[model samples]
Target: MSITSAERRSKDAIKARIKKIVQKRQSRRRCKLSDEELVLLALANSSDQWLMTAQIGEFAMSNSFFQKQAAQFLFGRTSLHASPQGIGSLPSRIESYLRTYGIPVHSKVDDENNKVYSMTAGAAYALLEGSYKKRSKATEKKLTTCPLLEIPIEIRMKIYHLVLKVSGFRLLVGTQSLSVYDDKITTWESRSQDALKMPPLNNFLALLSVNKQVYNEAMPEFYHENHFQFRDMGSMKNFLHNIGSERRKHMRNVSVSYYNLSAAAAGARLLAESDTLQKLTLTISATKDPAGHFTVNSSRRRFSSLTQIPGFSSMKRLRGVQQLVFNPRLEHDVVDAFLRPIITAPKPSKLSRKKKSNKRKRKHSELMSNHEAGQPAVKVSKIG
Candidate 1:
C-alpha cells in the first residue's frame, strides 16, 4: 500500500530526528573511546594492562564497528578498517592524529621507526576537549589547537605552570627551538622522519619578537638561562648594551665565555646588576690579567682597568647568588676581585648604629622608670 502525503512527511521528520540522535551518540562514543580505550579493551580481552602498540593494534583489528562519519578513527583503526583499504596504513594515520593532539609517540633512529604512542597530560585533555566536527568550513587553514592562544592571560599562566610541571625543568635545557605549540604539515618526506626538527633558540626568540602575546609568554623562557658566547670585542659590547635595561629577574642562570679581558669585563658588568641571577658560570679566554687595560683599539670606550667600574663593586646586587663556577685556568686574583664584594663582610652602618644606641638608651631609661614605678615596659628585638 502507498503512503499518503501527510504520513510520508511525518515519517521523514521522525527519521531525521532519529538520525540526529544517532549522530550525537556516535560522536560522544568516538570522543570517549579514544586510543586510550584501546588499552582498556586490550585489558578486557587479554587481562593484561601492559601491552605493546602491536598488541593493541591486533585487538583493534578484531573489534569491528559499522562505518559512520562520527570520528570512529579515534579508537585506533576502526575508521581505516571500515574503508576499502589495507591495515598497513593504520599506524601512520594513528600517529598523525595522535600528534595533532600533542601526544608523544616514541621512536628509534637509524632504522627510522616511529614506535608506541603515549599520551601526555596535555594531549589527553586536548583529546577530551577537542571537537570532532568541522565547525568552520569556509577556509581550510590549519586550526590552532593550543589552549594557550584561546584562554585568558591569567588562565594561560596557570596553564603554563601546568605545562612546566608536565614537561619538567629539563625542558628548558632539552632544546631551544622546539615550541610547545606549533602547526603541523603533512609532507611526503617528513612523513617518515624519525625526529621532529625545530628552529634554534635564536630563531625561536625571533619568532617571539613578532607578536605581543608570544613575546610575553616566551621572554622568560628566552632569558631563563642567558648565554653569551662571544668571539670578539664588538659583539660583546653590543650584547651588554642591549640587555642593560632589561629586567634582571629573568636572568636566573648565566654563562659567558669571552675571547678577551674586555669582553669578559663587559659580560661581568651586565651580570653584576642582575638582581635575580642565582647561578653564574664565567670563563675568561684572555691571557692578560682582568686588571690589564685593553687600549681603545676600536671606536668604543676602552677601560684601562675593570676594577674602576662601579658595576664590578656592585656584584652584591645579585643577592640570590647560589652557585659560582669559574674556570680553573682563570686568574684567582681576577676572580677574587670580581667576587670580593659578595664574600666580604658588609661595612657597619654608622648611622644605623647611632640610631640604635639612642633608641637603646631611651628604652633603658623607660625600663628603669617602669621598674621603680611598678609599670609594664615593652622590649623590641630583631628576629632573623
Candidate 2:
C-alpha cells in the first residue's frame, strides 16, 4: 500500500520511540529492578546508606514481594524491569546507590574479601532513623577504631602527616647484586664502568606501584635520589629515558660505583640535566671487570666529561654538597678534581676572625691570674 508522507513520518517516530523503550527495557534487565520495587528502593536509599539487598530482604522478611523489593532496593529500575536478576545486580545497585548520593565508596572487585560499607555519621543517622538508634549509637561510639577518612579532616590530616613521615622509601636492597659486586671488589678491579651500565632506580620506582596510596605519596621520594646500578649501558639509557630532565631536578644524591662508569656518565648526564643536584657520591671499586680479573687504569680515565655536562656545571650552586670521596686508585687526581671547586669556594672572613679572637682571648685568660696581676707585664706594640 502507498502511504502518505505524514503517515510515514508518524511511523518513523513510533519506531524511534519503540527502539528507545526496548533499549531502556534491556538496561533495567541488566540492573534487575521493577517499578514497585523501584519505589521501595528509593525510600530505602533516601539516606546516603550502603546496605546489601540481602540485608533489606532480612528487614522485610514478612513481605510477600521480599525478593522483588530486595532486588529493586539493591539495583534500581533499569529497562529490564520484566525479568530483573536481583542477585546478579547487587554490585551495580550498590554502585548506583553510592553514586546517586555523591558519596565516595572505595569499591574494588577484589573488595569481595572485605565487604565493608562506609558512610558519614549524618548519613548513618538518616539511614537508621529511630529503628536502629541504640545499635547505631553503640557502633558510632566506637569511632576511635574507624579509618582516617571516617574521622574529621583536621585529625585526618595529622594522621596523614604521621603516615607520610613513617612511610618513606626504605633502603634499596640489592643482596644478590651486592654479593656479586663484593666479589669483584675483592679482586681489586675497577668496576665503575660496568656498574654505570645498569641503574637500580627503576626497581625502586616499582615499589610505588605496590598500592594506590603508596603510588600517590612515595613517588617523589622514590625518584628523589635515583641510584642506577650501572651494570650495563642498557640500564643507563633506561634511566635517562624513564626519568626526564624536570624530574631529575629533585635529585640530590647520586651514588655511582667505578664499574658502572657508563651508568655514571648517563647519571652525570641525567644529573647535569638537573640544575638542582647538590651532591654526587662516587662509589669507585678497586676492581676493573665484572668477574674481578684486572684493575682498571685510573690515570687513563676521569669523570671530567661530567663537569662539562650542563647539569653538573650548575650542580655547584645547589649548596648542600659537603663531602666527596674517591677510591685510592683515583684518590690523587679524581678526589682532587672533585674537591678543588668546593675547597676553592670563598670562606667567610667573619668566621676566621671569630675563631682567632676566641683562641687569643682564651690563651690570655689562662695566663692571667689575680696573683700574676701584681707582676709588671710588657705589652708588645702592634705592627699595624
Best by lDDT: 1
Candidate 1 contains a number of clashing pairs equal to 0
Query: How close is every model to the real structure, measured as TM-score?
Result: 0.33, 0.33
Question: On a 0 to 100 scale, what is the lDDT of residue 76 in model 2?
Answer: 57
Clashing pairs in 1: none
Give the lDDT of residue 9 in candidate 2: 64
Candidate 2 lands at a TM-score of 0.33
lDDT of each: 0.46, 0.44
The whole-model C-alpha lDDT of candidate 2 against the native structure comes to 0.44
Residue 248, model 2: Cα distance from true site in angstroms: 1.2
Q: Over 4 Å off in model 1, which ranges?
A: 1-147, 152-198, 206-210, 225-228, 231-234, 247-249, 262-267, 285-311, 314-317, 337-384
Model 2 over residues 213-244: C-alpha lDDT tens digits? 54555554544533323433335445555767
Cα displacement (angstroms), candidate 2, residue 192, comes to 17
TM-score of 1: 0.33
